[model samples]
Target: MDATPGVISTLFTNAKVFTGETETTFASAFRVTAGVVDWVGDESAATGDITVDLGGRTVLPGLIDSHTHPALIAGTAPAAECFPPAVTSADDLVAVLRAHADGLTDPDAWVLGRGFDDTKFPGRRMPTAADLDRVSTTRPVLVWRCDAHSAVCNTRALEIAGITAHTPDPDGSRFERDADGEPNGVLTEIAAVGAVAAFIPAPTRDAQIDALVGLGEELASRGIVAVCDLLSTRIDDPVATFRTAVDRGLRTRVALYPGWDPVAPLADLAAGDREGQIRIAGVKVVLDGAYSNRTAWVHEAYPESCDHGLRLVDDADVLAAAEWARRNHVQLAIHAMGDRALDRVVELFADAEPWLDGIPSVRIEHATIVSDDYLARLRAARMSFGIATHTVFFFAEYDGYEKALRAEQVPDAYPIARLYAGLDPLALSSDRPATAWSGADDVMLSVEAAVRRRTYNGIDFGPEAAITVPQALLLYTGRARLLSPLEGVGQLAPGFDGSFAVLDRDVFTVPEDEISAVRVAETWIRGERFS
Candidate 1:
């Protein structure tokens, strides 16, 4: 019961300890000393200063979210929730916005909301500024689509941003307008959204830290002991924010990858500061946009659309960034979703293979729409690459993918089995607020989805793409550790960090569909109980 680090000794017995490698093998007990596993064996061989029984519960490696945007999620905490799960129609969305704006004392303050999916609306139409204008004409309102690739602003918000019929669209993005050349209040891609985002009030450093600390506790409660903050610099100083969060008693370990915009400061940031629970792992680059928003840069066009998705970063820019990461000996986490984007990324890696000798492994974030040919190319190249993907999107937002992609493409939407086909290391993540459902952060929910390949509507999306429970679990545990530069974590073996989660039931023994129902009874990080 005394789950604290720096204890002389602690023994955990009478539990099924899943080693994260195989499902059939287990140890009944483990001994921890000074935040490290001293020994793991049968109950008869256990020895420690204090002992407690787990009552035949299950224990596994503390979960690691290989890819997530904790900083962005925290930033959105102060905003109103207009996600599809909460609001189904444009009227419902307007009501939520009105309620949020009404609760705000500042009449002039912007009312911001996120996670809106117009595809799920009763009319299957995106909400326009006109729809939001129905909520409030005085208050400027901004709401992001679920993918964060698009957004809708009220007429007041447009006026505040100085966006008018004469305002030319930013490069790489477009402003949806009516037939008469009037701004429709819908903005697509980051370039367009950033224009209006400049007018929105930024969160204070103290507020950012608090939001991060709260997020850390939330992760710990879900049995997440560590996370790779894929995009860390949404705020001013991400490193300082993470350090402050740790100082405020955030037990979750963090590995940060700052944006690779200028590309000069990355080497210094990676070399100068490597302290506390945070480390600068590498640089992050977005090669393309999200599939849900019809901007994933696919080789083939969407169902009825003439053009493929957008490519956010140029191909040359991606290669140059890779070269810089290679020279600096850091990882390059490229966000690529469509086949074209992945192909370009694979080619870049292939070209940079010799330079990648001592560098950290390159990562492909959200490799959602990979093709077999590209997968073979990746395999043939024999490069040190990692695929950090999510099944939460498959379960939560398959409807959107179904609407945009061809029926044949749906089978490979996430492609967990195919990604693992060549025995490549795969790391699963939630992508948090970007996901379709509220339970995106729940590892068990993702596990069940990956194993069952079922969507929220109870339809089988891709049965052949389904993986076993153990394979899915490894994506969050052993396999995930390969993506991380951290050591002595993500396993329950001797010499590993004494971090593990005690589950209310043995997930390995339960039916696959019931995996999400499994709850974490206790979560320990560095032998200290966090939840």
Candidate 2:
């Protein structure tokens, strides 16, 4: 149950509390008054209105996922689960959809699913409309790629969206076609996919709220207390939807970075007074797509193809967004994954240095591929940008990346340690749903990948990029605040939000491989236990 404002207090004792600043720091007890930590000290000095023994459990500041898409996930909750690590083959994917279609009562309603990785399929080829048609020719179907940058739609869906061979490919995106000039139902990038997505029935506001509420509890159960909802404006009126979620009892604190497009004008969303557990911290701008989909806009050509990935946004648009964010006193969280994209972003930030004052630090989402020269350029520019990346992708989509990029580039894929070495206040996150793996949302899984530097198949992609257990923990806990404007979080100090995760064992002492298997015995948020 939630504590009534200003009337609740509790004391947690007999636990090893990791303050998150260092590996050796520990406290035996803490008291929460209302929703903030009132005191933290030895067990003998603890006192509160309500006291409970923790039985020597290990506790740490509640985990914060620096980047995620809760609204997008909620909006697509009706879709069937087609993420990799769950369904490995095209046939398995079809079976999952068939089962989902059979259970749906609406025969004519569109069937939607997300998180399908063609690279994981046995044939290593994306599923086409014909593949989905095998499940249902009558019902329109659209399944998003794991990257969410591309998608495959069934014939019915294509017809419904009016995407034909004659339809001109939108700028920065294209429609894959057959040799005979027919739409193959494969849409790449936001421009192409959004064209079809615009026609899909929008979930009701209540449904959206319910999806967020359910996801909040799910995240809380996994020991996540807050999330930086990257791309919050993917849905119309994200601010209102988040407000509704809070009213409906969302346990996780959210900091929103609505996507910034000059055409859309998100500066208005950043205006007005901030509300409880929800704030527009910045603007999100995507300069490129995912590497797994071969659209990351890298400097070099892919292994098999003589083509570097695609650049989704123009330089002029990115510069304009950066300037707008700076003027509005908000952070600009640019998504630049590829080497070429990072180069462009670094150049743009360097140019925008004049207006950067008074604004929160800029953030680069998914700095997946970085070279030594790129790092030197970033350091030379001395811009106030932080990196919020994911190790889950390194493990989940290792095969696809390995197949696409040069063998030498594999070790530098995530570059977790290297990012920390250059970018002060670096943070880590699981770009869940955007990643190929179903466990992308799991903190332990991300921690394990970051620490072990190994893929799911135990392939060492970038052992040199690995960090210590404490350093990895800081990415999700202590250092997360650098990526967002959320205060009184990422620590257990006095006046901080009384949020912490009670673990079954001390993760700091556990064997590295055993990290992912560690469980959250309980999770508390704002003076109340939710999971």
Candidate 3:
């Protein structure tokens, strides 16, 4: 993980840095050379091989996620089927898959699990393939349900993918069937879980470069140097698997993006002219489906159903992929959770707003349902937002898709206090394997659900959509520095990138329900520490 050559080693002295448009505290002492920030507010003209004091604690800027899926929680297996959080019967999720297949001794190899919140079980149903053949009718499983859209598999993984009950349902996805029309192994979206996740296998490219180098050392032990990879791997080349995990260093800075491909990994990132260290930068577009599975694409209807949602792309291919991502300058996130896929993604970015050439901004990912005339067309097209605060801690465990999205649009759910009294600037993302990927306790449970919009049933589901823990740490840091604000990214100034995040306590002086118990006492990143 080299690349720092011309000077400075590491300094860090008694810190506090969070200066992303200040709230206070610039009282610093940085100096991380060869990895940027060659001196941020003195400390005896900073020199270094490693100094580190930080006793005064608090140094942020190194969290930027802006939508993830880093190879599904960069798994080393055991993500207990993603987020079942609590099983509460289907024999308590077949005894959590028979104690995760009794620590697997190869009961037929493929036993991958995933998060499973069928709206907190008990009849929010979904698990059949005879509920994973009651946990291994001879292995072959497939779990995934907390909303990585959908998947359940099991009659020995639907007879090893031949998916019976006379298959057919794939177009734009959905294959559950039932009432005697059979095929009920449950699988949806990505055209019915991309035909059984294209028959499993895929992983290797050196196990996707050891799961993107153990997901960049688990986001540099949770201080996350930079991110925005936005999950995608059916493999047929993700820019040669991110240039073989950025020529093997995989140190994490990756602004990657690729998925929703009508063939666009842009020819080996213009045959490697996108320079490397994993930065391809742009092209996401989910277009709808996922408000915890009612299948978000709404323009009403949802309450008791009669389905008026689910539009996974197609408004003439969202105006021809927003005019081919504005004639190829690229960058176009666009997931849009609903509110009619965020008003047809603001009418296809206002019909590609006169071919947006210079590419300043353009993102949407989970811009969870907004509507004050689409927050005034995203503040008159100044557009950019990633939002996903782990669905406010997944509606604080209440469920049934938070009672059918509070009975259909409880005034636009993910509205973090109208994006903090709207002056527009957003980024926060944690859509990991669809929520709850560890480290930094999910960014301190997204700063205690954006400063207590209180859920875990204690109610107040939108106390004016609360916000403030320094505006949820500037939506995971300076509006995630507009996804690569000239690469120094999210902040902590000087030549940037010294990478921080220590936090054991003092999340802006805690007490927002004890900011999810703090604890991440070390993380660093470019300057190294790791965790």
The best candidate in terms of TM-score? 2
* Local accuracy by lDDT, each model: 0.81, 0.83, 0.65
Worst 10 residues of 2 by lDDT: 351-360
Clash pairs detected, candidate 2: none
Q: Which 10-residue window of candidate 1 scores lowest in summed lDDT?
A: 351-360
* Top-down TM-score ranking: 2, 1, 3
Best by lDDT: 2
Q: Is candidate 1 or 2 superior in TM-score?
A: 2
> What tens digits encode model 3's per-residue C-alpha lDDT throughout 445-490?
7678667866555666656677778777777776666544326757
lDDT, residue 297, candidate 1: 87
Worst 10 residues of 3 by lDDT: 351-360
Candidate 2, 204-312: lDDT as tens digits: 8888899999999999998899998888876778878888888899878888888876676754443453456788777888888888888888888888788787888
Q: How large an RMSD does model 3 have? A: 21.4
Clashing pairs in 1: none
Better candidate number, 2 or 3, judged by lDDT: 2
